[model samples]
Structures are given as structure tokens and as C-alpha cells.
Target: MIYQKTELGQRAMKDRHAVEITRAQRSALILLDGQRSTASVLDATLSLGVSREDIDRLAELGLIATMPGSASADMPRGDAQLTDFASSTLAARHGPMDLPVAPNNEEERVRRYKKAYPLATQITATLGLRGFKLNLAVESAQGFDGLIELLPKIRAAVGDERVQPLRDALEGR
Candidate 1:
């Protein structure tokens, strides 16, 4: 998702050397760089866990630039340096952003876990049950484990039960 620069973003850009951005923001920038509308950017960024406010702020800070109508330079460019810069800034300001959390309610959790289950299952399967089970147990034994350990750490983390069924399953419940 690409977010265009608003006047605020332009103004912010004029003064700042670099503005912090979340991983989603960076991905949005890569996807919706040149000629993408603010709305598109917002949609894309939101999907990646970035808030519209953050995108707007990044624009205001001049870290992201928005152009109109398919301009090549305006297109989302995948530059490792820019991504690194944005990631670093976000880390400094808010810390690292990573996996989605287990939802609070069963329905939401199920929905979220369903979305993530395949991937988690795939990884665990690749690692083999014994290894995966052992790893998960060790991590959760301390109150959190594996991806669950990181989910609550990200900003705007959601709690879902469906996604956690695997965690429960691993615990032999």
C-alpha cells in the first residue's frame, strides 16, 4: 500500500532528516510509492499493521514522498537502505514491530489463527513435531513462547484465540 504525502507530510519533510516508519509503512511505501493515492497507501499499510496516522506522520516528516499518476520515481522502490532507515527510526521511537497477536475472544482468535495457522504449521512441520513441540514448550513455559512471545510486544497487537489453538495443542491440552 502506498501513502501519498499530504501538505503536513511535505512540511514535515522540509525539517526532518528522517522520519520513523513501521515495517508495514515501509512495505506500503514499496508497494504504493509513485502516483498512488493516500487512500491506497492507507489500505495497504493498514493490512501490514501500519496505522494511517503513522503513514501521515511519515509523510509529514519527509521520510515518504507521494506523487501523482504513475510517475516512475514516485513508484514504490524497494531500497534496502530506505527500509533500514525506516526500520531503525521506528525501532528507536517505538521498538520493533512483528507478528500479529492472538485475539482476546475465541471467534476473533480463531479467525486470526486460521489466517496464521498454515504458516505456523508449515514451519513446525518442517522442524518436525518433537523439535517444534519442545521449542514451543520451552518458550511458553516462561509465560510466552515462540511467536506468541513477540505478538504482544508489537503496537496495536490484537488478541485472538483461533490462532492460539495450536499453542494449546502443543501444550497437550
Candidate 2:
């Protein structure tokens, strides 16, 4: 069976391993881009001293997974739909948009709320009922999972290209 890197894996690579991963693990990780087979990855990483254990470690970290043939598959979906929805919604209304920066500590949260409120209020006013709900949702969002769950709704309110910056801010990156 072949394994592909998850979004978290891509984030790890892009962020230069925010998690505690070994050199061998990183070596093996750079090879599982959804196109390579397990055997091919093993061969490619031979000089880097990568092993099956490294691959297993990535899987354990939820950084990689097999494609959708197995019973216990965890395939990610809805990105395209979200993008489409965001595109259409923004195009219909056609106005200036200000993205909210997520807050970390309590002090930052206060600052963030101050900044986000005016923008949210202005935008939401234009959107009517949906806008009001989105403003409340943005203010009430909790952690990473909460932010991710709210991403689709946010994109629908804003646009497709703005969520990553907001997520990065939320992650304190």
C-alpha cells in the first residue's frame, strides 16, 4: 500500500518540523508526496539512512496515510466546495474586505477583538443575517480545531485566499 502526506505533514515541512521529529523521519517524510510508493521512498532515502520505522513514526504522528482503499481511511474533503462558495459569495456582494487576525494570549485577544470588531461589523452589516452570525462565530472560535471548523464559514463570508493568514495568526506562527 502507498501512503500520502497529510495537510499536517505539508505544514510540518513548510514550518520546518514544528513537532519533534528525527532526521531519518524528516528524510523519509520528504519522499512521501502522494506520488511515490513505499518502496520508491525507501529506495530514494537509502543514502539518508531512512527506514520503515521512520515512515511508521510519521503515520503515528498523523502526518501521513494510505490512499482511500482501506476501511479505516481518513480522507479530507470539502476544500473545493468551500473555495467555490467563497468565490461566488464575494463576487456577488463586491466590497472591500478586512481579514481578522487571530489572537494568542489574553492581551493579544483583547487587541485582536478590538481590531476585528470594526471590520467584522462593517462587513457583516453589508451581509445582513449571515454576516452577523459570522462575526459572532469569529469572536467565539476557540482552538485549532475550532478555527478549522470555522474556516469554511469564514471563506464564505470573506474570500478563498484569506483563511491561511488567519490560521497562521491563530497558530502563533
Candidate 3:
């Protein structure tokens, strides 16, 4: 899901807190502007050998957290019920976000697919040998639509799976 810098992270960024980190790690911290998904940040940082691990390290350091009201599993559930999107709701609400926005056409779709593909694979990869069939499904999901179809099952298998790029891609955000 989307990540917002924690107060600690913001403080570290602004005051140059003595969190020992490399340049790439700093760049990753800069990218966590609370609007971009984890995968989106990772995709942008791919040329830098990906700051994915850096992002994780930052999160572990209490430097970043999933956006509030976004159904992230890590978010403290103060009283609001988090609805699961891994079942019938997905089928019933494949709304306009599901449609390829008419502007960028196939290129836009492809770019979204590329950004989302790895996130999907990462989620499935965590499933291990038990996910052999699911892994095959991911492998077979050649296009954006195919992957979109499998989103529910992926979520169902991995409760509260953190794959915001996939959701943003689905909703055309």
C-alpha cells in the first residue's frame, strides 16, 4: 500500500538524524511521499538496484508506515472495521477503474502492468511451495486483465497483503 513517512522519518529527513544510510536509502526515503505505493517507489528505484530493501529497512526503523484509512494490516484498528476486498466484492465492483483510461492507450496499460507485475509476483512468492498453483496462475497472467482477475485469490490467500500498486492499477488511480 501507500506509505507515509512517520514523524521520526520526517524528523530524520529534515534534521539529518544520525540514521546511518547510503545515498540510495536516502533517495528511497525521499520517494515515500505518502502518495506512491510501495511498488511504485520500488519500480522508480529499480535502476538503483531497487531500494526495496531500503524501504523495508526504513519501515522497520519506524521511519515509514502505510497510509491511514487505507486498510493496511499494520494500521491500528481504532474501531473502524476493515472490509476485506478479496472475495465477492472484487467481482461485483470491477468498475470504471478497471477500464483502461483512454488517453495513454496500450502503452499506459503496459506500464501499469509492468509496475504491478513484480508486486504480484512478490506476494505470490511469499506463498512458497503451497503456492505452486498460484505461482503458475501468476505466470499465466500474461496481461493486465489476467492479473486483475487473480487479485482476489491472491488477497484471499495472503490476508491483508500489501500490494498497493496492484490496487492503484486496478482502480486507475
Model 2 weakest 10-residue run by lDDT = 72-81
Clashes of 1: 20
TM-score of 3: 0.40
**Per-candidate count of clashing residue pairs (backbone under 3 Å):** 20, 0, 0
lDDT of 1 by residue, 1-173 (tens): 33455554454345443455555555555554446665445433432445455565566656566454434332223432433233333444445545444455666655544444454444434435323433353344333234454333221111233335444533324
**Top candidate, metric lDDT:** 3
Q: Candidate 1: deviation at residue 160, Å?
A: 18
Per-candidate TM-score against the hidden true structure: 0.30, 0.39, 0.40
- What is the alpha-carbon RMSD of candidate 3 to the true structure? 15.0
Off by over 4 Å in 1: 1-19, 65-173
For candidate 3, the lDDT comes to: 0.64
- Sort by TM-score, best first: 3, 2, 1
Q: Please tell me which model should have the higher TM-score, number 1 or number 3.
A: 3
What stretches of model 3 exceed 4 Å from their correct place?
Answer: 1-104
